[model samples]
Target chain A: MSLAHKGLPFDRNRVSFKEIPKLENGYSAKVPIIRDEDKLIADSFAIALYLEDRYPDRPSLFKGEGGRAMARFVEGWSQMIIHPFINVVILMPVHDLLDTPNQAYFRESREKIFGRTLEDVAATRDAKREAFTASLEPIRKTLLSQPFIGGESPLFADYIVFGAFQWVRVLTSYKLFDAGDPVQDWFERCLDLHGGVAREIKAAA
Target chain B: MSLAHKGLPFDRNRVSFKEIPKLENGYSAKVPIIRDEDKLIADSFAIALYLEDRYPDRPSLFKGEGGRAMARFVEGWSQMIIHPFINVVILMPVHDLLDTPNQAYFRESREKIFGRTLEDVAATRDAKREAFTASLEPIRKTLLSQPFIGGESPLFADYIVFGAFQWVRVLTSYKLFDAGDPVQDWFERCLDLHGGVAREIKAAA
Candidate 1:
């Protein structure tokens, strides 16, 4: 998304979690390692920052320094509230999509981290149903007055929040928002960004 | 804060909830109304925006429009999570500070709004203790890298979050942050802003 928003096209590298350690001969223990010539940057956020700084003339991600900082808070809010909910909701589905060895690896790693089976974790989604919806109050409230979290047009803050919905959209058919939800409107608008780029990828049933 | 942060000095008008209806001959029915010559602005946030736009030459409250929009999300998070907790924690203390007539008014109004007595509401502080601490995770994560929410220097986003803590500071002795908590460090830095303006008002004991 940082790359897409920046108008800098790049080839995709589909490395599994098991392959993250071997990238660039143990350069970083992360999935989002981007190789630009001799330089390799890891972490989604660091890559966005790097792209923003390294390519100043391209379309900006943050728009300004203030957006750069506040985008982190949005990230914190999303990761703390939205991601945990969405991750659980799609856990079983995600596990189903992986190959046999990777599926076992996924289950093992996730179970160890969560201390719960995939079925048990996904079951917890119903309990967190109300909270997951309520957690989006800030985003709903913001979209009431502005077209995007960054205001008027998309910025890093909008991208930061849209990433969550985009993730949920591709992995599961679960309806996270109500029919008239402001977030639903915002999500559609996001999908249409950069000439209907995100919408091209059909959602997994 | 919008006034003080903008290097603008203004007189304070202490109006009780009962007296809010009488302000400007019933022009507005809320607190934090700023009168500039013939114009009257209501709502703390609206007043801040008005000040930011009106006083362009003075120090900016938001620093930029990005901060302006993102500040609302910070406001949303604070009001959603922290405000509920702190309001309950300081319910009795705030009621105690009011005169007999105002105390009855405060208790009646608040209890009606909450559907519970001040005592019942304050008691909820204990149950929400863990969640309240956990809610500060985003702020904790942000401060680990930056000194303030807006990064490098304070912006309206910093003020938006700080208002909740500052409210608790002056109204009650309840410690919201543990010693060495990053939020505490940030709160102290906020208190020291504009020549320690917030600290001049001693805490309620």
Candidate 2:
């Protein structure tokens, strides 16, 4: 999204859970390792900083000064609260998409993080739905005035939060937010950005 | 703090709970009302926006793009979590400072907000302290990489969070943060800002 937001054309390299650790000749054990010319940057927030510094001429990811720092706070909030909830939600849908070895790897790893078996976690998703929506107080309150977290237009902070929302949207058809929710409205607006790239990236069949 | 952050000079107008509604001939019934020439801004966040817009030649309250929006997010997060916690914390200490009529107004209004008697709320202070600290996860995680929430220097976002902390600091000597906690370090850094004006303001006897 940051690259696309910057108008930088790139190729998508899809790798399953098992393939992530084997990338870049043992350079990283993580996915999202971006190779820009000779520069290989990994991790989303690190990549945001790298892009901001390297592509000063490009459209900014963190527009304005307090942007990067506040973006970090947004990332922290989304990662700690929102992303964990989505992780529990996407478990089964993701497992269904994985090949056997990857599925095994996925369940074992994800169960450790969630501290619950996939079936057990899925059992409570219905009850947890409202809790997830209620937890969006900060973001919901933020959009009460501004059109985006980055103010008039989307910024890196918007992408950080949208990544969490988009993660759930691409998986199950389940409703994470109620109809007419400001966050849901923001998500739709986000999907409409970058020439509808977010919508163009089709959800799993 | 926003005024101080922008290097603007101001006089403090301390109003009692009962006296607040009388400010500016009932123009606003709120504390933190700023009378900047002809502009009478009521809310804290609104005052911040007013200051930023009115004093463009001054040091920027929000240094870069996405700043105002991200600051709103920071304000939302702090108000929802931190400020409410401090409001509960300072209930008794604030009550202690008021005279008879003001004390009656304070207790009645605050009790309505908390939905509990002051004594009942005071009884749970020790238990709630750790919970308040636990809620600082986003701010703590942000401080892990950057020195301040707005990056190298403190911005309105830092002051938004610090306002809550400072409220507690002024009314009581009770330690809100544990020693050597990253938040404590950040609070001290905030205290040291603008020639230690936060410290010079003095704490309750």
Candidate 3:
């Protein structure tokens, strides 16, 4: 979304490993690798921050101390709580919980690492949802009174939280969040700013 | 320590329930609060970033994209992995997970709401550590070449990682990290910069 918002004229390709012919110099099995000029940056945060710094005039992703702190807090919170919860609850269940051949490797990996049965993993999905809701309460309270998490303008914090919320909304039956009037309004404003790739990504998903 | 490095007259006070008698009105019950003039801020990262922003001339706590990204990554990573792990492994074991008097009430409420047990919480901790180590291997490999995670100077990433590592080093016997040569050198550099606040914090612990 940050890339799309940059408004740069570059070739955007959505290629999958199975679709491409195998070759000696074939790309590694990594998604969303951005090749800007000579730099090939991996990792979403790295790419986003790099783009924000490179194109300062596009929009202020990180603004004041309050905004920056909120941004960092939300980014960390989502990565820690929201993303993992969504993965365990929605992705793992739909894709691998029933122990299909394609998911055999993942099942084995989960057992080796976590010492948990498929049922045990599935059972914790509700707890994950609860923890996620608990963590978001403070942020939601703040957002309910203000337009954005940082107040007034949508900053990097909104993007990070929006990404995680969007993932959960698309993937799960959980409807734990009610950002309320101010937050809902701010979210609409954010959509106006960086909704292009976000919508596209969701549509593809 | 950032305050101390700035030659500011700031006093460190350890506050607890028992120490309420010793603390003044405004300073009471705030376990990890910092007072600078009329401003008071809670949370470690918030304080660290605030100090850096307030005292820009002391030394660059966080710098360019590489530095900032590395710092943010470590900060996010610590909150994602270490913070929750600490809650389960150390805090729960010590019977002081939430640091509130309403533990029984909270436990009852949680049980009623989510039906989660201590064992379930512990399992999440183990899972988090496994996932963290798996994700961190790439970061560890990246640190092999550079004297710091970002290179040369000890960026805020070093401090962020150090803060969480301190907790892990003290609380658990999990050998998930080794400083190695480059990381060790960078660690030393960070210690020297802030008059060894990282060292002091660990020592105090």
Candidate 4:
């Protein structure tokens, strides 16, 4: 979305967790590693800063320095608040979509990290769903006052959050927001951005 | 903290929920309403904006337009994320500090809003405490990477979050953080700001 917002087009490269790409900086793993000719950048936040600095004439991922800091705050909020909840909700479904070996790798890694089976994590989703929805209150309230978290149009902050929802959308049919929710309206607005790039993706059943 | 950051000093007025002062805009309630000679501003956020624009020469509460927008994001996060959790933990203790009449008003109003007695809310603190701490992960992670949410010295974003912790501090000695927690270090640093204005306040206990 940040790349799209900046009107930069690039070929998509899909590297599964099972495969590691050898890159400079001695870092071989991470989905968001972007190779701009000889420049290799990893981490979404770092990439955002790189893009903003490298493409100064393009539409900004961050509006300015302050926006940059606040975007980091939102990134933190998404990491701590939104991602964990969504991860639990979609864990089993995501594993189901992986190949047999990939599924085994996913389960083993996740179970070691969580100290619980993926099935057990999915089992708690029904009980935990309300907390997940309630966690979105900050975003819901912000959308009430502004058209976007970026104020008038979608900014990097919007993409920071929308990425999580997009992940959930691709892997699960779960509806995280209720009808008439302000957040639902904003989510629809996000999906509609960049000529419906996100909207065109089909959900996994 | 923001007012101090701007190097502004003025009188302090304490109004209980029971008493409201009438003003020019026919808006009478809410604490933190500041009177700048002839101007009256309600709401901490509005006051911050007003101060920034009105006194641009002073130390900035927000660094720039992007900072302003991000500060609002922090404000939203504080309102929805921190305030609600802190409110639940300190509700009973806060009620305990009120005088007889005010205590009656507090209990009646809160019970009606929460749909439960104050005791019931307090009872859940043991179970809810972990979630409250978990919610601070964003702030904790940010503090790990930056000295302040504003990047260096404290900014309005820092105050937006610190205000909630300040509330918790004055009302209860509940020890919200474990020893050596990053958040605890930040909280201590916040207290030490503005010549320790927040630190000097006496706890209700």
Candidate 5:
């Protein structure tokens, strides 16, 4: 959505390890890669920041000091809260719901890394979810009072948070967000600005 | 040391909360406030960014795109890894060692919020520390290959990571970090830049 908003030529391709030849470096890579001219970049945040920096003439994804602080706060808070919470509850279960081979691999990976049973993982996940949701109250209160996180204009903070919240909404069927009237209006404004990419993604999913 | 390096005034007195009256708004009314007359800012990151923004004549703390990405990555990683790890292993124990009424209040607040016993928190913390340290292999590799995190120049990323690592060094006797020769040399360079302030803080402790 943000990529499209930045007016960049974004090519979305789904590739697997089998599709690519082995590198001389001995790493079998089958990840999403973004190419702008000769520059090939990896990592979501890295790509986003790179685009923002390269196209400063276009409308910015970040603003001034307050905007930067708010964006950082939201991004940092999401990593602290939403990422871990969603990983435990939604992603783990979704991985299990996949085919037998993938599920077996997932289980083995979880056991090897976390050293916990499926049931134990689920219980711990639930606890984290509860704590994360409770922690969102402060953020909710702050958002309720503002049109956008950084005041009147919607920025990258909204997109980053909205992305996380969308995943939670899809997985849990929970509407744990209420950014109040101004924020609600600002969200619609963002969708309009991004040429309804948010709606398109949500509808597709 | 960051405060000192910026040539800001520091409050000399450390007064008890009992000496001040509480605000009707339920927030701190008479708490000690660190002030910079030139720029009115509160948060450390805000202050750092503000200094970078305002003092264009001085070399920027955050450089360009790669520098910004490096800073954000380090900032996010430190919050995700270092803070929680040190809080559980070193901070909680040290708080207990202090055995102050304020420390007890802090423990109670954490318990009520996170719903974990101190020992449980500590163990969970240790596990996170191990995982974080293991994950740092790639980051260490990157740092070892460069003079600073953003290449030859020390950016905001260096300072942000340094602050967290400094805390760990202070609170615990554990020697967990080794980013090879270049990183160690960079660390010494940052300490040298900060001058006697770092030494003074350590001496005070």
Candidate 6:
């Protein structure tokens, strides 16, 4: 979304869970490794900082130093708060969507990480759903005050969080939020941006 | 904390739950209401913005518009996320710290808000501790990457969160974070700032 926001066109290099990228000198097993001509950057936050610094004339990912820091906090919130909860809620659906080998790898890895079978995780999600939604209070409340996490306009912070919602939306038909939820409203607004690239994705039927 | 960061001196006017101040023109009853010369501002975020706009030459709380928006998100996180969790942990202790009449007001208000007695709330703290700490993962993870939520230097974002911690700290001997946690480290670092004003506050024995 930040890349799209910058209007920077690039070739898609979507890799699976087991595929590790061979860098010029070494290897990084991350999906978000970006190669900007000669420069290579790994990690989303670092990539955001690199893009902001490299393309000073383009639309900014961060407004300033303080913005950059707060965006990092948002990134942390997404990783720690949003992604974990979303992952549990949509685990089995996501597995079914993947190729057989990738599905096995996904189940094995997630089970190892969570210490529970995919079925077990899914079974408990019903009990945990209320707490999970309650955890979104910050984002919901933030959206109540502003249109986007990036103030009036969208920035990297919006993308970081939206990515979490998109992750779940593309895999499951399960409703994480109720009708008329402010968060659901913001998610819709996010999906509507950049020619609706996020909304255009094929989800589980 | 932002006030101290900006080198502004303030006369503290402590108000309890029942004490609502009568303003000159109208009555807006909230704490942290600052009388800045002829202008009176209520709420911490509004006050920060007013101070930043009013005292342009002073140290900035937010670096730019993005920072301001992100700080508001942090404020929402503190209010919605941190405050509620901490309130559960320290409600009884907080009541113990208040004056007799104020304690009655605090208990009555909190009971109404939470739909439970203060003792009942505190009783569940033991079981809720793990989930509460898990919620702090965002702050912990962010601090792992950066010194403060506002980045290298303390900004209003840091104060927004630190205020939540400080609120619980001054009223209770109950330790929220385990020793060696990154959030605990950041809280200590915050205490070390502004000439340790946060650290200097006397906790309830």
- RMSD values for the candidates in order, in angstroms, are 1.7, 1.8, 8.7, 2.7, 7.9, 2.4
Model 2 per-residue lDDT tens digits across residues B54-103: 88898887887688889989987887888777877888898998999998
Q: Once model 2 is optimally superposed onto the true structure by TM-score, how far is the C-alpha of residue B125 displaced, in angstroms? A: 3.1
The TM-score of the first chain in every model comes to: 0.94, 0.95, 0.68, 0.94, 0.71, 0.91
For model 4, residues A29-92, the per-residue Cα lDDT tens digits are 7668887888888888888888999999998877766677777778889998888888897898
lDDT of 1 by residue, B40-111 (tens): 999878888898889889887776777788888887777788888888988998898788888988999899
On lDDT, the leading prediction is 2
Q: Which stretches of candidate 3 lie above 4 Å from their native place? A: A9-17, A20-28, A33-57, A60-190, A195-197, A200-205, B5-27, B31-56, B60-193, B197-205
lDDT (Cα, tens digit) per residue for candidate 1, span A1-205? 7788888778887777678799899989866789888888997788888999999999877767778888888887778888888889889888888888889999999999899898999999878888778888888878777888888878777877787788778989888887788888998998989888888878767
Q: Model 2 fnat?
A: 0.75
Residues A6-97 of candidate 3: C-alpha lDDT, one tens digit per residue: 66666767443343333224443445567788776665666767777788788656653223333444554566556776666655534432
Candidate 5 stretches with Cα past 4 Å from truth are A9-28, A35-42, A49-56, A60-84, A92-125, A134-165, A168-193, A203-205, B1-190
**lDDT tens per residue, model 4, B66-114:** 6776676787778886887788878988898788888998899899999
Place model 1 in a CAPRI quality band: medium
Clashing pairs in 1: none
Docking quality band of candidate 5, CAPRI definitions: incorrect
Q: Score the docking of each candidate (DockQ).
A: 0.67, 0.78, 0.07, 0.59, 0.07, 0.75
Q: Which candidate number would show the highest DockQ if scored against the true structure?
A: 2
Q: Which segments of candidate 1 are over 4 A away from where they belong?
A: none
Could you tell me how far off, in angstroms, the CA of residue B66 lies in candidate 6 after the best superposition? 1.6
Shares of reference contacts reproduced by the candidates, in order, are 0.50, 0.75, 0.00, 0.57, 0.00, 0.75
Query: In model 6, what lDDT does residue A97 have?
Result: 71
In angstroms, the error of model 2 at A84 is: 1.4
Q: What is the lDDT of residue A131 in candidate 1?
A: 78
Q: Write the per-residue lDDT of candidate 5 for residues B160-180, one digit (tens) a residue.
A: 767765665566666555555
Give candidate 1's error at residue B159 in angstroms: 1.2
Worst 10 residues of 6 chain A by lDDT: A18-27
